[model samples]
Target: MSAVTAPTKGTPAHRRSRARGPLLSKRLRMAGLYLAGAAVFLFSVFPVYWMVATAFKPVSEIFSGTPSLLPGTPTLEHFDRVINGELIPGVSFWRFFANSLTVTLASVLMGAVLSLLAAIAVARFRFRLRTAFIMVLLVIQMVPMEAMIISIFINFRQLQDATGVQMLGNLTGILIVYTAVSLPITIMMLRGFVAAVPKELEEAAAIDGAGNWTIFWRILMPLVAPGLVAASIFAFITAWNEFIVALTFLGRSTDYYTLPLTLSYYFGRYGTEWGSIMAASTLLTIPVMIFFLFVQRRMVSGLTMGAVKG
Candidate 1:
């Protein structure tokens, strides 16, 4: 055998190049991945950035012959117009905001509570028609809302006529509809969360002289709080952004209009008010962003935690 030789401090160019090749390739691959991620991020965020930029731009810049990435002079005139001017003949922006707030809160609250209770029953108990109930939920969720809206409206009108509850032309009608629409999926999602919690915890609590209610509220609820927050976010967004049902139910009553309905006002036969539209759209996104900021951690955790057991 020839004399064994090790690579010294000063190695040949080819050897050095071969040794460094993988590191250099790895760095290049990382750079390429980062560039790809940046491209996707820009693609996703550009529309939102454009909407906000347009919102701050003056009417002259908005309608300019040449397009601009930045506003020439930013102005709050569009926001002022949206806020100060009436979207409907007699209704103010605050009125519509309040209506949306009330409806969203009520539906989320009612739907969340109902979903939690139903999910617990389905997850923990052995009863007749349990599997059937789950199947029904799945079937109902598969059916599109458009297919059922006509029947719902007809039935709601009859109910209103019989009960004098004004179910067809009021916030209550929409609130009920929103809750029902969100229930099936909410229940399905929460069932996974409920099943993930150990029954041993409840048994231990019971052994320690805790009642059923105490065990449920103190031990179980805190564990599933993330799931609750996630479900509430879904319910809140659904109720907040629902347009067709709100428009159908509210009809010509502008007093009960939500933010989504206000976007329609900026369009007219003569010309569309692009500036005011963007401003109002920007304003509309703020509440959702604020809500997401508060609950984002919980939402992510809830989805992960529930998925573990499911």
Candidate 2:
């Protein structure tokens, strides 16, 4: 009689699965994802890290033969030069800072409001040419800013000539241009967000006798708050960092110069003030960092809530 052999735990099928199991496969995938994410973060953050490091670096250390990750010997000489207006005669850092603040904040506010209204209308209304309007907005967004810069310049200049109002380089002009430029994309983004919110919620609110404004402020705004914050951050950053239009418009007027133009005035044909430039750039970055920190929580909440609920 032949004895029957039982299958061991180390059988080929069992061993093969143990070696290439779901758990191991999952772990490998997770590891790869983590590595890719780390690489991306390092790539994105390194320039900002370098900028911060260079801002604190001494002129001698910056030009030194050996480059360092950290400042070799830190000094506030550059910062002092920038703050005390010792670098350029009659240049006011605070005034330029104020100009940037005014323009960026105003543009952000206007864009948010306009985007909110336009998005709501697009999402809710069934009007003639609605699709056409959306298509036009898409087309406008596709066009590069550089391509339209010349036409925009000419139109604004003609408007200025006809009205005898300084529209190109002035604060109001820049604010309008920035808001107009930002509106199409902002509206499109918000339209999608508004559409994502269930229509039943608005109907329920209306059934409860809630006015349009109350329903919007109480129900809808909170839901779309994250998108609003993200849009505001985009608008603020754009308006603050925008150099070309600011340069073209504010070039003739020194008193009306924003932070970017102020930086240009710091440089000269003969030599560049690298230290002061770095210091001023670092200073300009402070507000942007602060604003992002403030709104980041809301933005995250908005995005996460959407994903979880939707």
Candidate 3:
């Protein structure tokens, strides 16, 4: 054989090249995954960041031809105007905040209590049309709230006329709507939590001389507390940020208007108050953030414990 014969296909050099091929491919896949994750994170967080940044920027920088990611010179004048300026003549920002807080808290509390009771009935007791009722709840959720606004508004007016109680132009109507709107989803979420609790636990509690009330309060309620917290957050946010319902129900009653309605005051016939709008939006976001932070532990615990089987 010649001294310069060609190398065989199964040489060590060829094997080494094959091995490196897979490693390079794997590295490329990992890099693509990392890039996609970074893109998603930036997409989700950028709007919130922009809103907060705009809130702190001065008017000149806010309307600048080229927008900067960070404010060159931050200022608090917008916040002061939002907090102290009398945009609604006599109504202060605190009044709108109080209205929103009252409606949101009431709706969340009522929704949680009603949903828990209904969930218990659905999970534990088998009555007629129980399946049908659950289906109806799903159907109700599928229907858009905008589609029902007219009928709901009409029914409220009729109820007010028949009962001589003022339902419109006040917080009561919107409160009822928010609670009702939140009920279906809340009940569905709580039903799973209630059903996850084993019947044997209730039997054992009963054998230990625990009454129905005691078993429910001590055993069922505590286990379902996490789910209740999650449901309450949904109801709270819905009621807090709702605009069209509150606008329609409250009518021209500025005193009864919520924080969402107050944002419109920043948009005038002349031009939009961009800084004040962003500041108000920031203020609107703080309470929800605080509420979630307060209950985050319970929410996390619920997620971790939800998977265990009886």
Off by over 4 Å in 1: 1-25, 268-271, 293-310
Ranking by TM-score: 1, 3, 2
lDDT by residue for model 2 over 34-119, one digit each (tens)? 79999999999987877778778899988878989898888788788788764345757777888889998999999999999988
Looking at candidate 1, the ten consecutive residues that score lowest on lDDT are 1-10
Taking the tens digit of each residue's C-alpha lDDT, what string does model 3 give over 55-95?
A: 99999999899999998899999999989986577889899
C-alpha RMSD of each candidate structure in angstroms: 7.7, 8.4, 9.1
Each prediction's whole-model lDDT (CA): 0.81, 0.78, 0.85
Number of the predicted model whose lDDT against the real structure is largest = 3
Per-residue lDDT over 139-234 for candidate 1, one digit per residue giving the tens place of the 0 to 100 score: 987788778888888888899999988886668889999999889888877887898899899889999999978997999999888788888887
Question: Model 1 scores what on Cα lDDT?
Answer: 0.81
In order of appearance, the predictions have TM-scores of 0.85, 0.78, 0.85
Q: lDDT of model 2 at residue 193? A: 75
